[model samples]
Target: MAQLSDDCFAFGGPLMSIDDAVGIITAKVSAVTETETLPLIAADGRILAGDIAAPLPLPPFTNSAVDGYAVRASDLPAEGEATFVVTGRVPAGSAAATPVPAAHAVRIFTGAPMPGGADTVFMQEDVRVDEDGRVVLPAGLKPGANVRPAGEDMANGVVALRAGQRMRPQHVAVAAAFGLTSLAVRRRIRVAVFSTGDELASPGASRAPAQLYDSNRFMLMAMLKRLGCGVSDLGIFSDERAPLAASLREVASQHDLLLTTGGVSTGEEDHVKAAVESVGSLVLWRMAIKPGRPVAMGIISGTPFIGLPGNPVASFVTFVHVVRPTVLALAGALPEALTPKPVRAAFSYKKKAGRREYVRVSLRSAADGSFEAVKFPREGAGLLSSLIETDGLAELGEDITKVEPGQSVGFLSYAELI
Candidate 1:
């Protein structure tokens, strides 16, 4: 856990833009310093603690890139084919006993080390074998045509993977190629997640007349787990100042971050914001965004906290676009992984100026061979099914008010986010 300066609340005057909010979080948040060693098989999704350099040059020796006959380019005649004696054979795992001499060729396979004095490889298709155990070589073949030099893939003593990288499968493969069985990675982030509202009840339990099942808690917990965080579910708590403050203080000491839903707005029953302020500090950021504008970020003791809106769709969207990056930052992962791609708009949309908006859209292939973002028929933060029915969100910028069909727009797909 890390603490921010007391002046974090200084930028508290207006609804902050999405970019400004992200900048603030990136500037103020510090990554967890603790690290642990894990086997390469278990290192996926973990943040690297340090750079990994190649132990030796990749391939370690010059080899043939294809199954061919290793030969000297000079053996081929200037304008006609030349016959060469087949001296020896070399497969992928074995090396030639002696250097190839003039007018002689070595039978070679893919990945076989290139024999000395043989600078080119003629693929089996380009060479003809005779009954007398001789190879007829073609003319005009360039030297080093099918040979892979040592260190071609990676150089020795060079950084193969850098610090703060999230170890993907390909990254792990690189480590394995370098003969590393284990890797040093940042420890899994510990998270405490809860829902705040008396009107919320557990999903399996019978609910009272006006009570709704608590979906945000499970959602937050699953999302945290997907990010490789060690999450503790605090469950649902009533909107009371005393207990809420006490719980906040208790969990602050145990987890690296606190996540809650439903008590960030300025409504009368929204006590989570006040409770956080009483226990430590809270900056209510009325974000200049649609669906989930009321977000609270702060610190208690030293643990960071993020409060999200109660609506299921809003919680999902905010967590994907905002809290996901915050988690990556805290875990020491690269930030570029969160960038969304662009897609053409399939339907027209008109939005108000000064507020960014996200609309659920399913992609449809147009006659022009480009994918178009088709907006879902219904729009509401509380409608959870909207997320299930759509492929992704069509992100509309704050400066843009109207988007016509076929216009390019930034899109964030659930596949990428999840």
Candidate 2:
């Protein structure tokens, strides 16, 4: 864990640029060491702790790609078709007792191993079968046609999956193909999430004079869950310092990461910043990005603490941009794991020069067969409906003073992050 300076909350200097803020967080956070072996059924979405090598070839032997007659290419009749005696039938999971002989064909089904000395197969549609079940080779049948060679899919001792790769359903199939019952993966990081503010009220609670239902916690939890983290909800914390401090101390010892929304800004009712400063260290606050400028990062009792903005849209953006990547890295994921490549902007909007901005935009296809991005009507950070209606966030650089209607800007697909 990294400690924050006493002046970490002082947000006066030219609003920290988005790039600089990412670099700071990347440099400060340390990766966790916990790991475990999980069964194949439970390994989906988990990060691989080691490379998965193939113990043997994927197919393990030459087999038929389709249900057809297997024959030697040289044994075919010169002009039309060559007739051969059907030696035997080989189905999937069965072995051929004897090697195939010249001028002989074998009846094989899909996925069945190709008998030795047979190098090609003719589909049943291409050949005619007599009442006695004997088959005739078709004309123009090429050598090695429709025959799957040994080790074509995967060679023996080949590395199918590299270390640090996140496991998906396809990866699981690869493991099963290699006869692996389980895989070594990093354990899910335990995260404790909460919101702090007197004005915040849990949903279904009686509305206070100036209180609003706290939605940031739900958003945070969803984002954490998508990152494969085990989340512990701490609920909402009042403005009092004692309860907040107790909750922080208790969760710090039990969880690998602690996250909270609200109380990170400069408002007097913001007690999360103060509590973190008193108990732990506040590393950085107030990023240069719009809609999510009031972000906080710190460490408490060797556990990482992320204080997201109180606004719903701001909280969602900051979590995807910052907290998600941090959590992934702490869970032993590679540095390049969370950062997605920028898509070419479909539409453009206006912005000032010094600050970075992320605009919610819906993607549309144009008459010219190209994608055109359209911005949401509302730009306020508190407008949650804008995110729901939009496709993804369009990232504007700090140097971008004005954007033309069709100019290309950096865009991030929402599906890429969530």
Candidate 3:
């Protein structure tokens, strides 16, 4: 793991913009140097450690894209249908025994390699066979039609995948097409996740009168897993300054990141800020965002640590904006910025200027035939139901203070946040 300087994330502003926060993490943090090779089957979600060059051209051979009659373009009549002798047949796995000659058509099935001297094809449905046993090809059937030239999809030796790319199923398919069984990928980032607060108790545990189940820890771990992180669930640490500080130091050596869900704010009960500072260093990030303004970015024993807000919604939102990019940087992956699609707002909203806000919204079909965003009825960061019932979020920029029905808004689906 790469260690950042103490001042790398240091900012003078009272409230940092989300973009500025992301930029600092991306620009200052260095990726871990370790990598591993895994079979392409298990490589999905892993980052590419190096470029993948195509071993051979896609398709590898010139073939027919459909069941057709292959013919030489020189033999076709320009203004009318032409009759030709059917000389040979080519199935997907079989080849023409001899080169197709001029003035002759060869029966070719989909995926069959095109025979030599044949530069065009006429779909079997578009031609007819007369009683004389000669096949007729239609006029204006352009030359080279229906023929899939070798390397048409991608040429040999081309860079098929680049370094720092997260492998999707489509990328795996491409690698398989190139006859590759495995790929070199960066190892999953090791992260230690926990929650902080004396009032919190682990789920399924006997709860005290003032205690609530620790939901943020489990939520953060799940989110980290989606990012291909090797997560160690450290459970909860009570709001004790000394004990919390000791635990943070103990785990810092084993993980690339230490993430806590609470105790980052300036409240007296918040020990995460002081704990981190005692162990190593801390930078309180008063981010200019809704539901997650009090974020903490720090370093403990050279490992990066981030403390998100305690509320469930705040934790979820801050994790998406803060911990996400930090993890990507550590894994050597390219920055995956979330881009919201434009949708019509069906509800009115008001927010302060200079602070970004994400409104939970479900999309519905509108009379105009386009998708419109409908806001959730209730509000509060603690309501987990809001996240479950919503399809995505409507992003209100820092400059915007209000919204009206039919206004254009940027919406981000939950599917792409990771």
Candidate 4:
């Protein structure tokens, strides 16, 4: 946990750029102090505590890439077909007892180790077997056609996975291939979530006049869960200072990060910002991004605080673009692994130059063998239907004043980020 200075909230200057704001939040994030050793089966989606070096080569031996006959590449006929005696058969997991001599071949199956004195494999389909178990090479047969050299996949003593690498299914499989039963992984960050507003009620609750059911919490929780975080739900908070302040202080010391929706703006009823200021420092108040402009980032008694907008889409967008990366960094993941590559925009839209905009759009392939993006009809921050119909956000940069049709722009896919 890291604390923000009181000078963080004193400035009333222009709203910070999205990049600068992200830098500030990430700079204040502290890595978690906990760690755990988990079995390979439980290591998926966890961050590696240290680099993993290969103890043995991936295949561990030179092997055949196809079911074929192993022979020395120099022994093959230069012009046409050649004949050889098939001395023995070697399937996978069995070692060749005798070395394959010149002008002789050994029947080998896929994954079977290459015999000594043999450096090439001819596919079984390209050869004819005579009654006496002789192999006849076909015309145009090339040497080394199907041999897989040892250490081609991985060499011993090589770094298989780097420290701070987030484990995926493929990573687990690689570790298992090296006979690793377990891995040292950083503990998942514990996060507590709540939404603050008098007009906000939980979904399925009766709504009074001018009241709207809270949707940000559910969306935030889903995003956090997808990021492999341990989440605690605090439901909704009222507009008063006592309960809100008490709740903030109580949960601050218990979790690595505290996330809330609403109550950070300058509205009269907004108390979350004030409560945070009294207990901690609000590092950032606003960003130059559309829909999620009211985003706030701060530190409370060493625990990081993220305040998202109450709007359903805004909360989700901000979480994906900003808080998601911050949480990942705090969990000890590499910075490059946090954000995804910007995809080329499929469709064109309009926006002002100074501020960044993220438009929800669906992606489909065009007849010209490229992705054609189609924007959703509704762009409201509170409309859940817009997100339902879109695949992800098309990030319009802060430089371009106008975008014309057929021009490529940056896009962020939901499947990639979430």
Candidate 5:
């Protein structure tokens, strides 16, 4: 589990920037020390524990990159074309039976090893069979034009994969190509998720007249799964101060993180703030971000805790920025920057100058085939439909006060968040 001083996150302010919050989390939070070995196929999405050195050179041998005739560059006719007796055929996975004599060519398929004494290839489509059944070669063809040299992809004993990388399918392909059967990766971070509020009810449970079904907890769990976390679904607990405080302290030892949605703000009925204070230290961060301004981060028994807002949109937006980084840090994964793609904005909007805002938007192609961002028609943090109907967020930076159509703005796609 992560270790931290009670006052590590002591830096607070009336309004903090997202960069500041992330800086503290990255600087203070220690990655868990445990690690596990897994099969190559199961390594995807896990953090690499150490650098992976190539066992052997990629391709391992010199081979043909295309179906063609292999010949020595010196034997080619200087002006037009020349023909040579068809010496032998080399198929993929097979070696040459014998070296080709001068003035002879070999029929070689893609991935087949070049016959000894051959240093050039003429693509089959670019050459022809002569009347004598000999292979005709084109002039002006470069030697080694269609050959994959040994160690062309990577050399043996070189570091091919680095530590702290989140493994992906492409990375798996690299390992497989290097003949790796297993990999070492950091253990998945364990998380405990729950919610608190008298106005909230479980999805299947009977609801009181003033209660609505809880959505934040379920949404948060889904997000956590995407980050490769092992989550224990601690169902909605009582909002009463004593019970909530007791629950927070009891679960901190078993999990790397304790995550809650809602009940962190200073409301007359809000008990989470006081509840966390009783058992752990809390920092109520009012970030300079729209939709997710009020976020609560704390420490309990050395485990990190994060409390998101009650609003579904706010919860979703905050998860990508706050919870995602914290989870990566805990799992020993390197920081993955969320780089927004620039797209033309089709909607006009205005906002305060000093705060950063993410406008939910859908992208469409413009007249010139470029993508333009279209904002959701309605605006409210509580509207769950806004999240579903939109494709991603349009990032308006702190210096951006007003936006007009045709202006280029940074866009963060939903696919990039995880």
Candidate 6:
């Protein structure tokens, strides 16, 4: 549904910073124009098509915030305990039968509506019931201390959830509370995914001694599904320019976006760049990031295309850093959710200047009760096991050359990305 810009790689030449790349994507990609109405139960993880305004205030009435005695603060003794006649009882889901009079208290339960003249509540434990049907109160109590004002959670006619928001269980609960049986959400994104390499074989299938089972495609499929895309796996394509070109054009015509892992590098077997260029145009390639330097962004017949690296770790890292935001932008949500967070580094490390790096790291509990990121024991784009073992990636910026222990650094969690 989104189109690529003509000068997507105009800034900072061929190898661009992560911020610049994301900026171009955020600016060029337009949200899908289609929408659908679905039942509230079916709207989980779907982007909201329109803003949800509160039909009426939440709770709808002023009520007690605790199980206690509701009484007018003015009726209580200023500095000592006092006894009040028990006038009436009001439990949750029931209204007060009569107005609370001075020197009288109403037995109220949590969520019960406050009596007409009662402005404060004393917890049941703080009060004692005498044999004469009177309640003895404590010396000190704040006015309106245990009261839930009308519309406390939400105000009437206010927007409870804005458009482009992904609906979660709590959001569904709000919709249910507003008596909405259904909601309007953006239609699912249509994605076509494939892998490129003669040495890659399908998982669980027979493979040659030199060939390896393709894990990147399955990982891409799962990631796309988690992002709420309607994915179509196009299987694997060999290193053939003509066939791959024809397939790219055909798939682009049928899907909103085409995603492939491998064949962007300048090698003899790499044909994806050539194919995409022959059919459409190559907008950008070669990001300034470690393990994902070969990532490519382009367009085919008005459909956006992203070519990830062949290595599983590179594919995973690039998808989280680059492709994930592009897909979210196409889905009508703001692509700012994946921004990096700050964390402390437990292990000291050194990196070259002018290239950003994401190191797989596990979180360690420090003696001072704070979290520190420790790099994984192993390294390499081919070692996919590191991803499974690490809690997240510790990001070192292009300007940062060295990190000492306990130093604050940026962190990107796999839990948040997926």
Q: Count the backbone clashes (under 3 Å) in each candidate.
A: 0, 1, 0, 1, 0, 0
**Clashing residue pairs found in predicted model 6:** none
Q: Over 4 Å off in model 2, which ranges?
A: 1-14, 77-85, 130-134, 139-142, 336-348, 409-411
**Cα error, candidate 4, residue 68 (Å):** 1.0
How does each model score on lDDT?
0.87, 0.79, 0.91, 0.82, 0.91, 0.87
What is the C-alpha lDDT profile of model 5 across 1-418, one tens digit per residue? 7877899888655788999898898788899878999999999999999999989998898889999998887777778888899989999989998987898999999999889988888899999997889987778898788989889999999999999999999999999998889999999999999988888899999999999999999999999998999999999888799988898899998999999988898997879899988999998989889989989999998888899988999999999999999999889998899999999999999999889999999999999999999999998999999888989999999999999999999999998898
TM for candidate 5 is 0.98
Which ten-residue region of model 2 has the weakest summed lDDT? 1-10
Q: For candidate 4, what is the total of clashing residue pairs?
A: 1
- Across 1-418, the per-residue lDDT of candidate 1 in tens digits comes to 7556555644658789877888788777788899999999999989999999999999789999999799888777788888889889999999988999988899999999999999899999988999997988878788789999999999999999999898889999999999999999999988899988879899998899999888889988998888889899888888789998999999898888899887877777788888988989888888888889988888898788899988889889888767888888888888855465788887888998999998999998888888889999886899988988999888888999999987999888887885
lDDT of 2 by residue, 29-72 (tens): 65666689999989988888988778999788888988888998
Across 214-241, the per-residue lDDT of candidate 6 in tens digits comes to: 8889999999999889999999888899
TM-score of each: 0.94, 0.88, 0.97, 0.94, 0.98, 0.96
Better of 1 and 6 by TM-score: 6
- Which stretches of model 1 miss by more than 4 angstroms? none
The C-alpha stretches of model 4 lying farther than 4 A from their native spots are 1-12, 139-142, 337-348
How much is 39 displaced in model 4, in angstroms?
A: 1.1
Worst lDDT 10-window in candidate 6:
5-14
lDDT of predicted model 2: 0.79
**Residue 275 in model 3: lDDT:** 86
User: Which of 2 and 3 is ahead in TM-score?
Assistant: 3
lDDT-wise, the better of 1 and 4 is 1
Candidate closer to the true structure by lDDT (higher is better), 3 or 4: 3
